[model samples]
Target: MPTPALAIVPLSRDDLPVDTVELARFMIGKYLVHDTPDGRTSGRVVETEAYPPGDAASHAFKGRRPHNGSMYLARGHAYVRLTYGLSYMLNMSAEAVDVGAGILFRAIEPLEGLPLMEARRPGVGLRDLARGPGRLTMALGIGQSFDGRDLCAGQGLWIGAIETAPMPVGVTTRIGLSRETDRPLRFFMPDSAFVSGPRKLLESF
Candidate 1:
C-alpha cells in the first residue's frame, strides 16, 4: 500500500501577520508538528483564543515581563508556560516583537502518532486525548522547556499544512481563568467533539 501523504509546511513569522482574530481562525484544522530529538508527533488544532495588547485579560497586556517576555520577543515564537503548576498551555506570539499579542492553542485532534499521544496520556479516551489547552500541550510533549523557542525554526516543533475539512466557527468567552471576563475572544470549531470544555453561548456569560 502507498504511504499516506502528509501536507507539511514550515510556517514563518511573516506568514502570521494577521490580527489575533484572523490568526485564531486561520489556525483551525492545521496540524501542529513537534519533531523532538526523541521522536515526532502531530495534532490538528480545533480551538483557539486570541488576546491583544491593552486587553485586560491578556497576560502581556501591561508589558513584557520575565514570565511573559517571550510574547514580546517576536512573532512565530512559542510562549509556553505551566498553569496551576500542573498543566502546560501553548501560545504563539503574533505580529511584531514586543507587540503583546498571541494566539492560544486551545485544543487539538490527534492526527499522527496516536501511540505517542496515548503513551503520553494513557487511559484517556481518544476524543479527550488532546481536547484541552494543557492536555494537548502535554500530548505534544510541550512544556516550559519549549518556552521562547522559535516555532518557525525550532528543531523539534513546527506547524504543518492546513487541513481540508473546514469546520464551522464557534465563538465564546475565553476559558479557564483570565482577567478579561467581558471580552468574548475565544474561537473554536463548532459541533466538534474535540473541543476542550463545555460549550456555552455568549449570553451564558
Candidate 2:
C-alpha cells in the first residue's frame, strides 16, 4: 500500500530539473514532506501547474529577478514566494540553473500532522486543508524562508516517493492566467477529492 511517506527522500538534481510539463505530470502521487516545530506534515501531490522557460505566465520568464531568482537554482529546490501579500506560494525548481523552469504545487491530500495543520488553518475542513498553493503552504508551515532550500536534503522539508501503485495523472492547460493559456501544462490526480479548479477535459496518463 502507498501509505504516507515518512522519511525525507528528496528528488535528485539529475532526476529533476526536467522540463516543466514533464515534471508537473510526473509529480502526481509523489509525497511532499515538511518537518516543522509543530510536527511532520506530509501529503500526496494531487495537483500541479507547469510554467516553462519563456512562459509569460511564469515568474521566471523575466529571468532571475530578485523575487524569482530561486527558480534558477538547481533542481529539487523550493522557490517559495509571498503571494497577494497574504499567503506564501511554494514552487519546485526544475530544469538546470538559468533555464528558469518551475512546477507549482497546487494541491495535496494531507497525510500527516493533521492536528498541526488544523491548528494553523482553524475552521478549515479536512478535504480543503491543502486544496490550493497558498493553502498548502500555510498548512505545511512553509514560508518564504524556504526559498532555494534543497528538497533532497534531509532538512525540515523534502519530496519523496510512495511505496505502492501510483495514481493516474490528468493533464490540461494551465489555469487563471492570461499568458500562454493554451500551453497544456497543468497536471492533477483526477480521483483526489482535494483537487481544485474547474473540471476541464483531461488527457489521461
Candidate 3:
C-alpha cells in the first residue's frame, strides 16, 4: 500500500447545492486563480460571507438586476459587482440556478503572483493586501469583465485545489450590514493572516 495523492479538481455544481452557509464554509480552504494578460495570480480563500435570498443585506433580495444577475446563474460563475460605487467585490454563485444565493470572497492568503497582485494594487501593506472584499478583488484584478464568467469552466478564472488543510473554521456574524446582521453566516480559517474584518480574539488577518 502507498499513500494516496491529494485530488485536485474544479468545484462541481454538486459541491455548491443551494446552501449558502455550507458553500461559505466549503470555500474556506479553496484556492482562487485568475489568469490575466500579466499572468496567473492565485490565493487561498480565507474569509467568506454567505448571502441567501430575502436577507436584507443580500443583493438578490430585491430581485436580480443588471449588476447581480450572476447570482441567478449556475454554480461556479463569478458574481463580480461594484460596491459603494468604488472598487469591485468578487463572489461566486452557489446553490441551484435561480435560487439567488452566493458566497462573498472577503479575503485570501496570496500564494502566487505577488508582484502582479501588487502591481494591480500598489502601496498596500502586506497583511492588508487582500484583507477585505474590495481589496481582494483589486488584488486579483477581477473586475466587471469577470462578471458571469464560469469559474469552473471558462478561461482566465477558476478555483484550484487547496494546498493546505484548513479546518475548524470560526464563524461570525456578517460584517458591515445594517439589517439581518445577527446571522452567523461568515466563516474563516481560524488564524489565516489574510482574513479580513474586525479584530477578534480568535483570528487576526
Q: Candidate 1 vs candidate 3: which has greater lDDT? A: 3
TM-score of each: 0.88, 0.92, 0.88
lDDT of 3: 0.80
Write model 3 residue lDDT over 1-205, tens digit each, in one string: 1221334456656655567777888888888877676677778888999987677788898887887889999877899988889989999888678878788999998867788889878898778888999998888888898899988862578886645644778888889999898888888887687788763534333
Model 3, residue 159: distance off in Å is: 1.1
Supply the global lDDT for candidate 2. 0.84
1-205 in candidate 1: lDDT tens per residue? 1232466677776777557767877787677888755567887788889887677777887788899988886777889988889899999887676588898999987877777889999999899889988889878988888888888883578875653655667778887664877677788777678998767755311
Can you write out model 2's per-residue Cα lDDT over 157-194, one digit (the tens) per residue?
98887566766788888778988888888898888899
The candidates, ranked best first by lDDT, are: 2, 3, 1
Task: Give Cα distance to truth, residue 76, candidate 1, Å.
Answer: 1.1
Q: Which candidate has the top score in lDDT? A: 2
lDDT of each candidate versus the true structure: 0.79, 0.84, 0.80
For model 2, name the residue pairs that clash.
17-95
What TM-score would candidate 1 get against the native?
0.88
Q: Between candidates 2 and 3, name the one with more favorable TM-score.
A: 2
